[model samples]
Target: MRTYALTVFSQTGEKLLDESFEAPSNEEAKKIGQARLDETGYSEYTHRCVSPEAKLVLFHR
Candidate 1:
């Protein structure tokens, strides 16, 4: 498992959420992010993943 930094932005470029959590892979991390957005009532957003060392990690769209 690895820790991933997550950020979610609304359609109009507003940041709706920021968090850090552990996940097995980037794909799983994205799934979790999406589920979180759905649970939190955010329907449209873009997300980015980052590594603990401040590197940009890519997530499948």
Candidate 2:
């Protein structure tokens, strides 16, 4: 498993959500991150999910 960071930000650059989760792959991390965002109703917010290697698994602006 690898550690992934998921973060969400408001339009004004306010940090909304910053969390870490474990996943077997970057693709899985992206799915988990997107699910979390949907559950939190932040799907339309600026967000990013980064892999342990600092690669972007998912990003939305």
Task: Provide the clash count, candidate 2.
Answer: 0
TM-score of each: 0.58, 0.96
Q: How far is 60's C-alpha from truth in model 1 (Å)?
A: 11
Cα lDDT tens digits for candidate 1, 1-61: 9898877776677877788888887778767766766787653557677776666664422
TM-score of 1: 0.58
Score each candidate by Cα lDDT: 0.70, 0.94
How would you encode candidate 2's per-residue C-alpha lDDT over 1-61 as one tens digit per residue? Answer: 9999999999899999999999999888989999999999999999999999999999999
Clashing pairs in 2: none
Winning candidate number (lDDT)? 2
- Each prediction's RMSD to truth: 3.3, 0.5
